[model samples]
Target: MTDSHDASSGAFDPASATIAVVTYNRSGLLTRLLTSISEMDPKPGHVVIVDNASSDDTGEVVESFRDRIGTTIVYRRLETNTGGSGGFSEGVRVAYELGSEWIWLMDDDVEVIGDGLAKMGRWAPRFRSIQGRRYDFDGSEFYWQYRIAERMGIPIPFAPAGFDESGYKPMNSGCFEGMFIHRDIVRQIGLPDPRFFIYWDDQLYGWLASRKTQSVIVDEFVLRRTREIKQWDMGIRHMNASSNAYRYYIMRNRAIMKKYYRALGVYQPVLFGLGTSLTFGKELIRLLFVERTVRGTSNLWRGLRDGRAISRDASFRTMAPLTESVD
Candidate 1:
């Protein structure tokens, strides 16, 4: 898991790659992430840091690393906080505009091991996008359910067993941390959606990308997350223990889920509709017995109503690509 690599087995141009990291007010964690990235072997050709109008010392941290890091670090600060979706959109647009052959992306808190990028760079040309394994803060493997539910086209939380480490598994989903994608895929699917504002954006984009080409989740590369893991019933872990606002997005994006199913076939929507009803009942029970929040019931009703209405509306617009408005 160090700098050791056997590129003779599969060599790729490391210089043709660019990295896009989106950050908010997490300057302290960003320092560690950037440091690890700076130390990556055959470093990315360019490193783009999209700061979403952070109020902290993120700018100063970037400046300090500018001279210290071994790569060309480009820091772009937005005037407002546009969330992860917006930040990644603008960052990727910039990377694409800069003419990079491959674009690697991550959040502010991930630490990239040198060998991960080296391995991903070697396989950059093979797939549309490649995802590396992520380790939790406790050094345990994270994102246990890497498999996207074949019927629903959503990630289901289940760990796979007995996979060959040397081979790749077909993936219809993606995580920003340690995700490596070719520029051509960007041309086909466009940049990641900013209007998603946060949750489900990556999955939607991953779905779109996979529709046009092949993407894979492989263990050849790796990334480690530094966060507290939250677990739920039935071996379920909320890798992202989201907030009320995030919950809103989670519910609202069901429209996106509906849209995805509707595109597949006539029966998919019917199946998904039935499945959603069951899920809604389970959620209501969870809120009643487990959560019991003061306004949880009202909020749940509002979210479900709005989400379904959003999906049913005729004017619902898919998130437009930031690259389309690139200046």
Candidate 2:
């Protein structure tokens, strides 16, 4: 996938963009992210922080930023923990309602290290959706190689050597961390489904955006991870040791994906089934051999069972489109 559009026509204005950050109990990390946002050279006009009913001082952290961030900060605390998916869904909706032309979405774990917003804006005239690269906590480039297996309806890893002269790779998938998206695309595809609860939501949302307009990840280092996660280095790629909860959602979300693919008239049961089985096997292998946690298998199978039920439910087949009026 390649995009030949010229991006020199105009630049994106930071003032027109709204930064949306989703947080849970990570108040310290939230502070780090907010500090970086406060230091952005051309600060965004609005910042929306969605607190997923954190038990910590996450709300006070956002309140502290009110006087320091130099932007219109909107803080929303959900009554329940809806996980990353719900936090981002609400964040995007709030940002869109605020009349922001572009929305920058991320978690509390990453800090903007450079003019990532400015860099993303450079490609706004050409691409409706864009993703920027990030550095690991140790300062190495984080692994973000991804491509959508259209027939299988899932994102799979790909080599990172195919960047265009403009320093971007056209992608059918996205990561919520530092994703710069336009409001027009949101109107077309709707908010990220909250039911996903965590995994694969961004990939499906990105694929949906790509269907509307070209989506690309620019070769720009804009974020640095603040948290250190345990992972096994597999030479070619690194695999992070995921939690049991993540293991569950990772499998269960495959069912939610089928619903979206079917709505879009591209669901192939045989191929999707094959893909799901392969995914289950890969995760099982990773858990047993790589992560050395056989106990997580229960979560995996349970997720698969529940996911099968979700696939059978008629209500899960459709996504609600966002209102066109951003009023």
Alpha-carbon RMSD, each predicted model: 5.2, 2.4
Q: What TM-score fits each model?
A: 0.84, 0.94
Q: Could you give candidate 2's per-residue lDDT for residues 64-154 as a string of tens digits?
A: 9899998889999999999999999999999999989899999999998757778777778878788988999899889885577886866
- Highest-scoring model, lDDT: 2
Clashes of 1: 0
Relative to the true structure, candidate 1 reaches a TM of 0.84
| lDDT score at residue 9, model 2, on the 0-100 scale | 36
In candidate 2, what residue range of length 10 has the lowest lDDT sum?
Answer: 1-10
Give one digit per residue, the lDDT tens place, for model 1 in 217-265. Answer: 8766368886554444444444333346655666666666676556545
Q: In candidate 2, how many Å is residue 111 off?
A: 0.2
Candidate 1: which stretches are off by over 4 Å? 1-11, 159-161, 233-240, 260-267, 275-298, 319-327
Q: After superposition, how far is residue 10 of candidate 2 from its true place, in Å?
A: 3.8
